[model samples]
Target: MIKVLFFAKYRELLGLGQMTVELHSTTTVADLKNRLVKEGGDHWAQALLADNTLCAVNQTIAHDGDAIADGDEVAFYPPVTGG
Candidate 1:
């Protein structure tokens, strides 16, 4: 299973900080985001916009094509803001 973490508004929408998914070797970051969008419906769709959202795999930010494997940890969040 690949562990997934959601932060900020995403966490609130999903009511979860983390989850685990079983995916095939062919799975990519883009695929995972699609799955989240499907599961979370309209609300998650907005937060998961590819251009605005960010993803990390194993604590390192990853691109859309990055391959995901079992036991990997993935996190998603929006861009941060600071004073």
Candidate 2:
């Protein structure tokens, strides 16, 4: 299983901080996002697809095409800003 985490506004929008997902060995970050969209529907779209959301794999920034493996931890959040 892959551990998925949502941070910042994404957590609030999705109403979830974390979840475990079972995915195929060939799954990529894009695939995971698609699956989330399918499962969570509009709420997922709003939180993930609506903006330039950032992602990290095992605490390192990752792109949509990045590979994902079992036991990996993936996190999503909006871009950070400061004054």
Candidate 3:
């Protein structure tokens, strides 16, 4: 299972901080996002599909093509800005 975590605004919007999903070993970050969108419906689409949304795999920033496997931790959060 892949552990998915939502942070900041996303956590609030989704109403959950984390979840576990079963995915193939070859799944990529984009694939995982797509699955989440499908499962969570419009709410997830709005939060995850936004252009500014960012992703991390196992605590390191990652891109769409990054490979994911069992026991991996994936996190999604929006960019932060402060003065």
Candidate 4:
């Protein structure tokens, strides 16, 4: 399974901090995101599909194309701003 996490604004938006997805060899970060959007419906699509949304894989910032593996943790959060 791929452990998916939501943080900060995304966590509030999604109403859950973490969830698991079935592991598939061909799955990439984008694919997993799209799956979540489908399952979570319209609300999820707004939070996850936003342009400023960011993703990390196993604690490392990742691109949409990054491949996922069993037991990997994927995190999603909105971009942060500092004064």
Candidate 5:
């Protein structure tokens, strides 16, 4: 299982801070997002697919094509802004 974390607005959108998902096979970050959206429906789709939504794997920035492995920790959050 891979651990998925939701932060800030994502937590609000998904109503959970974290969840464990079973990986069926080799998968990428985008693949996981698609699966979550497919399973969780509209709200999940909005949270995960929002423009500029940031993702990290094992605490390092991750891209949509980055492969996710069993036991990896993945986080999703909105882009930060400050002046």
Candidate 6:
């Protein structure tokens, strides 16, 4: 299973801190996002839009093509903003 974590506005929007997902070997970060949108509903789906959200896989920023594996930690958050 892959451990999925949500942070910042994304966490608040989903009302969840984390989830464990069963995935195939070929699954990618984009695929995971699609599944999260399904499990988390419109708020999460909308928040995860590519232009607005950020993702980290195994604590490193991940691209859509990045591979996912069993027990990987995938974290999601809204884009960060600061002065």
- Kindly give the number of clashing pairs for every candidate: 0, 0, 0, 0, 0, 0
Candidate that would win on TM-score: 5
Candidate 3 per-residue lDDT, tens place, 3-71, comes to 899999999999999999987667999999998899779999988999999999999999999999899
Tell me how far the alpha carbon of residue 10 in candidate 3 is from the true structure, in angstroms, after superposition.
0.3
1-83 in candidate 2: lDDT tens per residue? 98999988999998899999987676888888998999889989987775599999999999999999999999999998868
Error of 2 at 74 (Å): 0.2
lDDT (0 to 1) per candidate: 0.85, 0.90, 0.92, 0.88, 0.94, 0.83
For model 3, the stretches where C-alpha displacement exceeds 4 angstroms are: none
Candidate 5 segments exceeding 4 Å error? none
Best by lDDT: 5
Off by over 4 Å in 1: none
> Model 5: how far is 7 from its true place, Å?
0.2
Query: Candidate 5 — what's its lDDT?
Result: 0.94
Q: What lDDT score is found at residue 65 in candidate 3?
A: 94
**Residue pairs whose backbone atoms clash in candidate 5:** none
Report the C-alpha displacement of residue 30, candidate 5, in angstroms.
0.5
Residue range 1-83, candidate 1, lDDT tens digits: 88999998778877788888887675898998898788778877776764778899999999889988888999999887868
The CA lDDT at 31 in model 5 is: 97
Q: Which stretches of model 2 miss by more than 4 angstroms? A: none
Taking the tens digit of each residue's C-alpha lDDT, what string does model 5 give over 18-82? 99999888799999999999999999988999988999999999999999999999999999775
- Over all chains combined, what TM-score does candidate 6 have? 0.86
TM-score of each: 0.85, 0.92, 0.93, 0.91, 0.94, 0.86
Residues forming the 10-long window of minimal summed lDDT in candidate 5: 74-83
Q: Write the per-residue lDDT of candidate 4 for residues 16-74, one digit (tens) a residue.
A: 99998887676888998899999889879988899988999999999889998899999
Arranged by TM-score, best first:
5, 3, 2, 4, 6, 1
For 1-83, candidate 6 gives per-residue lDDT tens digits of: 88989887878887888888887676988888887778767887777865968889999999888999888899988887878
Per-residue lDDT of 24 in model 5 = 81
